[model samples]
Target: MTHTPVDQADPPTPHRDLHSEQGALRGEHPGRAENPVIKVADLAWLEFEKPDLDRAETFARDFGFAIAARTEEALWLRGTFAGPPCMVIRRGRASRFIGPAFRAAERTDLVRLAAATGHAVRDIDVPGGAKSVSLLDPSGLPVRVVHCGEQLPALPEQEPLLLNFGTDHRRTNTTQRPPREPSRIQRLGHVVLETRSFLRTLDWYLDTLGLIVSDFLFLDGQRRRGPTMAFIRCDQGSLPVDHHTLALHLGPGTGYVHSAYQVTDLDSIAAGGEYLAERGYQRSWGIGRHIQGSQLFDYWRDPDRFMLEHFADGDLFSCDLEPGWAPMSASGLAQWGPPVTRDFLGANPSPAKLREVITALRDDNELDPARLLGLMKAMSS
Candidate 1:
């Protein structure tokens, strides 16, 4: 089941040809090439601490994820459509980095490589007996894998409250004026992570995860846009597999850069951002557009200071073919928006504020300020 990287001398296989037999959904766009491997089935789960559970839950709901279930130790959230839980918050000691859930090819290659690489497969005892295999990628991000067929239904328009007044009813629809309704989570788009070793991590993902770099963000010493990041797509599905499922940023510790959730339209992005600001969630950057994926984006901080994004209309490549790399510059992140800001990348929090942020990530009893204060001082210096 373990797949060694095809020797570079052997040449890249025709990924589109491999997928021709799979019945994967091929977009109508001409630029996209057929991908034979991964299509994002759904976002499985994400782990966070429990103290910030309420804030996290509220943010997710407003951002369009529906609450599936909650316990003293964890929370399970899903999209509006029926599917396995997509987000999971576990009671944990570390607020740094957790892992990502991925749908794999029907073949056993990924699963075998995961075990060979020392990752473990375990059943998440949430509600549904969702099975997964967890292992670290070359860059150290925890990657979980499972075969496909775990598809969730799409959202249906059945809410009477969302109905027009008096068009189909004799009564006035007061629910419209009651409160803002959340847009539904349509699909998982991509995750961005910070790592000091960009190329090394990129190589690891390509060798192990069967991801191909569609495009990259390379830069100079500063944030000039070069291909420092890898936008990897699954190779087993039909053409133009879901644009990049993951992106890697050059930084320390496998911490979050951001996680993108796809929504129905641009109006949802504007409405969602307004809702977050009214609730006092710190707006990081955006309510703008990006140069690469071209999603209308808005970024914000969770109670733990993790970044979550609401995006619409990302540019989809027709194929997984390498489109070449660009130099990394701060200006490259957005084609047109307020210039890239520090807070948007989460580098501006004072050490004390960051400590409070992490403290909020813990359960009711596990917080310790003395230890956190020391860690903060070290990071600040």
Candidate 2:
């Protein structure tokens, strides 16, 4: 007797409100590359060109970075972590963000990356001697992949204050007093950038440096088109790393948005924010827990108007987890915090921003009329 064959294909999985488990099923781009040139270890440092080195150093100190090295032409800022400096600010005619540098896992990775990108590996002229391969992203931002010969030794850091939780008391007699000082940044957490060619730039980093997306945010009504913002992290195999080492979002202009540093805890963020406010520095946003990374954050503006964040208790993910997809909205920014600020959103109208919008609309890049409208809707939503 002949038996009838039955189809055993599983039904399609439905997308959840918080995350989409099946990217391929939804016709979305996979968050990683099959064969990348190199897998970078972490973000080494961010470079900036500032006109006033003295003013920059003052802000750096106030923002909780220890001066790793200072010279007549440049200043190197570091955290308490034993690694490369968190930032390098060079004296220049104007104050602007130069770009970010990623640390390669091995010297051979740098060689492989250089060979694949056709860029020669050159020596980095910073505090620690290093070899780097420099390249420009699709949005014209300079990116460096460096393999450093020496690592900066860990410095003394402020300890987290003991606290009493629900039914669990750590401190019995001590008063709950955190010092009114800088939050004492532990390490650079992540950097966020705005780029006109978001997809191209995103693909470049994933393909070249082997970064993977931790989360993806798509504009309202533009899910089919693709994600407009991506929180990307380094691929460290089974080791859990920061939810985002770098984040990129599509915008009319290409520039730095903000950078985050890890602080001890909520008390540190609050006390540090108070210290900054007392010093006449502007608070952009925060003292709230973010939804994506689950980090308690406080954003402040430096003297030069660059935004930096003091964050703590961020999520970490291993390489096995798939990227989560969510809709982009202002309300979705944080789990608990004050309403998102206009300054943090770049909503304050400016002549330079107006000019950028006009130029981007007229250009041949990715920012189009519909895309811009979707972005605007996303911001307002």
Candidate 3:
């Protein structure tokens, strides 16, 4: 896979002193060992739209993200978190791409992660009070890390179909207070990937990035779902984190696996799902429970078709643990759902269809036609 080398932007001004020093995690600087007040806080992903920047921006706002800022090249979206930007939409003639970002407890940890992983880490200076380290994952999507932000915002329930007093006022259970919304991201959780070299990628993340395997799926020659799938956690805890922050599958080019966002509880998962549906967004998967992370899961497809998941009540660890190697099989992927569906993996968009759409957008002068068209056409053609 080839890409135009990004113009080497100036590195962000280092802020080694400002980070909260608490029970700083393992990879942090030796001097910052006592910094315990760390939060796994926030995550950022990509959404690429071919023809309309306005449409993409509108969808993001309607979906509960706050529009932090925009430029000719991209639009930065923020959730309730106090971080710079949790999501970004780069003007392009393509769909969504999930790029996962891992947080560093301190600047020293960033140094360690960059050195050990061989990922070129650069600081990103955003306008006003935003700062971050922008880098690329193995899959080539932009990923970044910055300070944590506020919690997810509270959205009102969609108006019921009938707004009259005569509407069905069924028996009310007044004892229960309305459920609380999901908490702000403590830090970015994990990202799953589908790659041709699953083992190699998995090993790279573990060896270079300091991620520990909580569990794994041992597969046979045919790639049929086996008995167990592997689970890995960051090597900084005793209680296993929502298992497997990053996962990979044997398949095609480095495309997204799935980006998992954390919420506070099961009620928030259900409430948020309902809230999204009422707001007229498309719900892709879930509203079901999962076997591995042990959370209530709900998935929605954003405008660019990236699968964004809302998970609540997940398993956590006391400390970073080792990998749990298990048999890889079909049945083990889910604890409960209708069945594993192909659409979830994004088998819908074929190469030809994507090319056609890109072509149409370029010809119509939609989006960043001049700058992005060349890249889109090359990939598509």
Indicate which candidate wins on lDDT. 2
Q: Report lDDT (Cα) of residue 24, candidate 1.
A: 19
Which regions of candidate 3 fall more than 4 Å away from where they truly are?
A: 1-51, 70-73, 81-84, 96-98, 112-121, 127-188, 220-230, 238-240, 345-381
The ten-residue window of minimal lDDT in model 2 covers 1-10
TM per prediction? 0.70, 0.95, 0.62
Per-residue C-alpha lDDT of model 1 across residues 294-356, encoded as one tens digit per residue? 678888787677888888778665543544344444556676777666787555768865564
Q: What TM-score quantifies how close candidate 2 is to the native fold?
A: 0.95
Highest-scoring model, TM-score: 2
Q: lDDT tens digits, residues 182-250, model 3?
A: 323322355666553444444445444455544444333211222112355554554445555666654
What would you estimate as the lDDT of candidate 2?
Answer: 0.88
Those runs of model 2 whose alpha carbons end farther than 4 Å from true positions after fitting are 1-25
- The candidates, ranked best first by TM-score, are 2, 1, 3
Error of 3 at 190 (Å): 3.1
